[model samples]
Target: MSILFQAYPLARAALFSMDAETAHEVTLSTLQRAYDCGVTRKLMHEQPETPTTLMGLTLRNPVGLAAGLDKNGAHIDALGNLGFGFVEVGTVTPRAQPGNPKPRIFRLPRAQALINRLGFNNLGLETFIANVQRSQWRQQGGILGLNIGKNADTPIERAADDYVLGLAGVYPHADYVTVNISSPNTKNLRALQGEDELAALLAQLRDKRAELADQHQRHVPLLVKIAPDLTDAQIDAIADLLPRHGIDGVIATNTTLSRDAVTGLPHAEEAGGLSGPPVHELSLGVIAKLRQRMGTDYPIIGVGGIVSGKQAREKIAAGANAVQVYTGLIYRGPALVSECVQAIRGM
Candidate 1:
């Protein structure tokens, strides 16, 4: 393990002492500087290369950095160096907006979890694309997935317009685009996962992708990110929509509103989505059901509550084509990336 990865406990202690969002900003800024100075290269050991293919895109490995960690795509190259097969950035929207009120993120250390209602706070689509253009992650041969969502001020009825604008703006730069409809932070965003809303959204996206494909002369895959707080019927409903709408893949789970697993833990009652070990089974259940419903060939990227390599393998065992990490990264540090890659490759 690299010295930096090994020192994560101490780093986590320091970061944990600050407010969650502040610590997040500090980490990203420090990482960007570290990468610029070539420090990350020295601190990160060579990760195992286990080439895998998903949704027609080649991944160096099956482990990915889930969206929300680097909301603006600003740290793609830096974060990618920590040994992810891919780094997905953003929940960016059509217009810039400050997210929910302060204290939006809470740490629940005893349960090894976090609850956040960040509400897609980001630098907006144009600035996000500019950051993507400035990054070397794409040229470095790492798969880059851009995740898009609707702006908060946009009414739920007109949500499609924001998504349409998002799709057109990001289609050219993304290796794949993740349509994030499952973030519990955004008001009524999870409603998009409902059958009627989901069907209409996917239909529009399918047509838009067709038009964008013609204009860009390259077909970028579209994947939908769903929530763990879904019923068996809802899971089946989503599975039925993907292929029908020409959706390329599904990211099984964003975060969960259910606190069943951490009922009395600190921050457990917080309003946002709960992530970490708490959501593991919920995510696996969704992945398993999606695989059963979509059959063997449909692409499913599993994410939610993976704090260990064993859990990473569990995602695959439950039928994930690939896996992603966000809360796991926060608690376990960079070493979790290599650990997951090795575990999944070994599988």
Candidate 2:
């Protein structure tokens, strides 16, 4: 536990000194090498049982590593070894993309938060699948969620084409696939969240999923990732459309466009989605509203601002069926996983 917990403050001190994007690459590459050489398990604290079921998938625990951190699915095995019940990867597009320019990711340590407008940078679906095939997570029964998105270069009108291409390619490799339309960095992407466009997008993917399920003789659940900036009426409208579209689940949030939580903190005015502590309340509010509208059976994977076990509990109490983490993993290290597991079960 100390190895997982105590080592981080110094490591974070070093990481925070460098540019956020550089630090991200360096850390992930290190973890990947550790995983490749078979020492990844040593980095994690063993977590207690906190089994959860969502979208017909059985998770060892409800705590998962959220999408975005392992955007290309490059380090799924290493991340899986860190104690996440599931690890969701990618906002991967149909083709490789360099994403936005450098200085795209910023840290606000005082707020225990981060803001990034990475714009779905990835190695495209082909390389992403090859990496997934090379990983040990699936062999070890770690559930995987593959998140898909349209290319930054793709026209908003053709977005469904990219999503369909992604669904077809990843369906054979994924436990589930998330449709990511909520990322603030993607230009006009959130426009898809509007009523008519959302219905059209979901309709295209639903048809593609049905075709893929038959071809693979397997079924993969599709979950939509939504934003925190939505009004109550917009959320309700989307909720009303979910079951009708055969959308199996929803991830309550990606990140927030709202900066009200951070006020005058450093980089608080950065042009990207705000994450960590600032996102918690908005995430809870979204979850509560969605849970009420989606009703008891629909799945919601709650995310945002989960720095400790108590916040994890608050997400569930707000009606999340399962929860995921990214920024908390940054602040608290792997011990956050065990802490969250313990905290949630005790509740």
Candidate with best lDDT:
1
Task: State the TM-score for model 1.
Answer: 0.98
Residue-wise C-alpha lDDT for candidate 2, range 1-347, written one tens digit per residue: 46546777888899889898999998899777867786657543366667788898999899999999998888898889888889999988989999999879999898899999999989999999898888878778789999999999899999999999999988889999999999999899999999999999998988988888899998899999999899987998899988898999999888999889898998999999999999999999999999988888899999999999999999999999889999988888878988888888888
- Candidate 1 residue spans exceeding 4 A from truth: 42-45
lDDT of 1 by residue, 172-241 (tens): 9999999999999888888999999999999899999999999999999999999998988898899888
RMSD to true structure for each model, in Å: 1.1, 1.2
Clash numbers, per candidate: 1, 1
TM-scores for every candidate against the unseen true structure: 0.98, 0.97
* Residue 200 in model 1: lDDT: 96
